[model samples]
Target: MSGLLGNHFITQIGILVNDIEKTSKAYSEFFGVPQPEAFLTDTLDKAQTEYNGEPSVARAKLAFFDMGSLQLELIEPDEHPSTWRNYLNEHGEGPHHIAFVIEGMKEKIELLDRKGFSLQQKGEYEGGRYAYIDTFKDLKVLVELLENDKK
Candidate 1:
């Protein structure tokens, strides 16, 4: 089914964790998949990260476990102020956001904004960009928007 963001396909489920090594190992063993190596996100200049409407230097170590059509992502954030760091601090380590892959990033963000969903943070990655929207009050989880560059 489709929603305000357009398509309803959930591409990823992000979790905040205190320890990436231990947690990723456990998940790997449980899922019978090789342990995915954790990698640091891009630096601030490359990532062009913004948090709470201001530029930020936040970064995180991330590991992804591909589960069929969806991915389970583990995030261990640094001390900087970011969506990952803030959520990890406030909620202590658990499910953080459910992400959807979309096409028009700017339009989707604007639509969500019109609906009163605040954009908490945004950043760029190697292949795509992401935005974290504060949809916790209604959905019990933040909603992430992933827009990959067309190859």
Candidate 2:
């Protein structure tokens, strides 16, 4: 995690879907597991959201499934202009981004910025913050950095 270019372990894989209920059920059936509960992002507190580094009201329906050490995240973008929405609009539903769990978000974001990876979207949850870095052009997928204070 010291440099911008290298092999980084992915902790989560995020997918953009049109319907979270349908997708979660389908994935649950496929994995022979119970369907995960979906959460609305807008309901979170102390949430500061941004799109393309500017303040924005981007919301989404999110669900997570634990798979051993890595987690799979499902995202259904709300009717707003956001990274997820733009991704859905441009490419339809599918894999959207891969994420890494970071400890120091500010330092990591600064490193990415210095490396020319712009912050596409960012938001703060109760005990953590998450950001999406613009990496689709080179990696064919957006990159995410998550910093959880609880962890």
Local distance difference test values of all predictions, in order: 0.94, 0.88
lDDT of 1: 0.94
Best by TM-score: 1
Residue-level lDDT of model 2, residues 76-128, one tens digit each, is: 99888999999999999999999987777877788888878888999998788
As for model 2, its CA RMSD to the true structure in angstroms is: 1.9
Clashes of each: 0, 0
Candidate 1: tens digits of C-alpha lDDT, residues 88-147: 889999999999998899999999999999999999998999999999999999999999
- For all predicted structures, in order, the TM-scores are 0.97, 0.92
Over the full model, what C-alpha lDDT does candidate 2 score relative to the true structure? Answer: 0.88
Misplaced by over 4 Å in model 1 are none
